[model samples]
Target: MTRLLVVDDSALMRRLLGELFTHAGGFEIAFARDGLDALRQLHEFQPDVVTLDVHMPKLDGLRCLDRIMVERPCPVVMVSAMTAEGAEATLEALSLGAVDFIAKPGGAISLKMDLFGPTLVEKVQAAARARLPKARRLAERLRLHRAEPRPRLRPPPMRPAPAAPVGLPDLPPLPALPGEIEGAVVVGCSTGGPPALDALLAPLPADFPWPILVAQHMPASFTGPLARRLDKLCALTVREVTHPVPLAPGHVYIARGEADLIVGRRPAGLMALPAPAQAEHRWHPSTDRLVTSAMEPVGARRLVGILMTGMGNDGAAAMTVLRQAGGRTIAEAEETAVVWGMPGELVRNGGAEFVVPLDGIAACLLDLVPAR
Candidate 1:
């Protein structure tokens, strides 16, 4: 059983979280009433995972997160309210080495908290698999951890698999541009996606010529901050999609968490965010819808599908469809993936034209479809 530490100032929250893990199965729960208590429990309980509340007495989540990452780096899942401040702190926590976060539903915590059970368990299990390295020096850890957590996601330096399985896409030679719009790349990722995206996208030059679309599993509050964070690190312009806007080359469109971000064929190609889906889709920013929607307007010949690390097979089949239609597609190799579920599924179904590690994904993308 995985040992878990539940830290929150509210006794009810503490008990509720404990029960959540209990119902999820395969976890040993330890409780901490506050951040100070959490620090004490850290040594005594030695949990494999932690679910820390953002607001706590004595030692708040931010300070405690800093200490935990610099002192003894481990996987942490922050539990926070679904508010602006909570979202900001949660994103900061992720940069500080917390593996993921959970948003509290509005109002009082009731049986609604139980609705979070499965997601909590999945994130905890993922964290256990992808523990951060012992951060080494405090200053070094802080500097590296904040700037780019994705590089840490890379396994200890090893020879990248020979370039055979990764190269120019197998599609037929392309025709001239349609005049109205240039080609585009649609990306799907979850779990440890932000860091992976950072690693994959930051290296591209500012003049990168293709429009990029990212459909990562996240909530409304989290996605905007993530885009802003990546924009600071990347040369390419990154913006969150709130209203429908035509995608421009050399820019990045991050899918809104509240809706399924899809491309539509207007007089010129365009971007549209429909109503948020409550059923028929497991994730809010559904990659399945994104890829399928691009088939006609974007065309398989001019599109690139990239399925990265995530829990489910959300984009696998649609990625295969792109391949069948003569478009290029790639998956993050298992060795570099945090969970390998999405990418693994893509490889299993033979959906990917290339299976590249985290470090090589950008190169592979460049090779598959040269920038316009």
Candidate 2:
């Protein structure tokens, strides 16, 4: 049986989560009221997975997470509130070592329970089985039981490549005005996108002309924090787009899971459309949906499609359609991607016009957008 520890200060939350996992079967459950209690239980129960809450008293979730990675290094899923602050903290936990997370429903218990409870149980099971990497193991060992101080981690060496081909048969010719698109900028990324996007967005100047719509493959609860983290790192305003908001230039809108981030061009303007129904593709906030919607609004001239690091061909098919519609397309090159699945597929299928490394992506985008 999979062993799980549920760490939360709220009794109701603990009970609900514990019961849900119990009902799911194949799980041995334990409970902790806070990070301190969690540590105590960690020694005693030796759980395979931990569901951690970020806002606990005495020791916050991140502190406990550091301790866990250092001492035992089990898979952890952070439980966070739905607010922006909660999201920011949860992303920090992910960087520290937590595998994934779930958001606690807002005020509506029934609605929240219905949406989150079963998903939480499912993620717990997945986490229990996930393999911890060697890098993480080394980091844990250094943090937990240090005989000597560990050396600072050096950034990985950069690998350079020849300039990517500009014009290909299946792709449209490079636009004369590379950076001058009129409508929203739609991006689809997964797997290695977190760091890749950091590089791609870092060099963008403030006062960019269009809003960015991103469909990143991630768990439902993770988007809030991921957006906040990106907001701090990027020049433009970044936030998780809730329902009914129109897409506007100058903002970066990220899509949450359990839905597809669709774009609609109303008479008034472009809007961020969310559908909470079951994911039509294997990935949520699907690249296909995002690209299709962007095509509807901007047609060829205004749409920009970027496929970054990820597994599988989720974006390939949609990119073909986007190209056909005269939208500009770019893919992350293999040399810089953690996994080249999505970007590689786009290149193989003739869906991408330009393939650039992570560092070069921002410059390419700036070149593509028109000067204001």
Pick by lDDT: which candidate is best? Answer: 1
Tens-digit lDDT string for candidate 2 (11-94) = 988888777887789989999999999999999999988899999999999899989988888888888887778867766676
- The models' CA-based lDDT, in order, is 0.77, 0.73
lDDT of 1: 0.77
TM-scores for candidates 1 onward, in order: 0.87, 0.63
Question: How far in Å is the alpha carbon of 308 misplaced in model 1?
Answer: 1.4
Give one digit per residue, the lDDT tens place, for model 1 in 49-82: 8889999879999888887775556688899889
With a 3 Å backbone cut-off (N, CA, C), the pairs that clash in candidate 1 are none
Q: Candidate 2: lDDT of 118?
A: 75
Instruction: Tell me model 2's lDDT, rounded to 2 decimals.
Output: 0.73
Model 1 stretches astray by more than 4 angstroms: 131-169, 172-180, 272-275
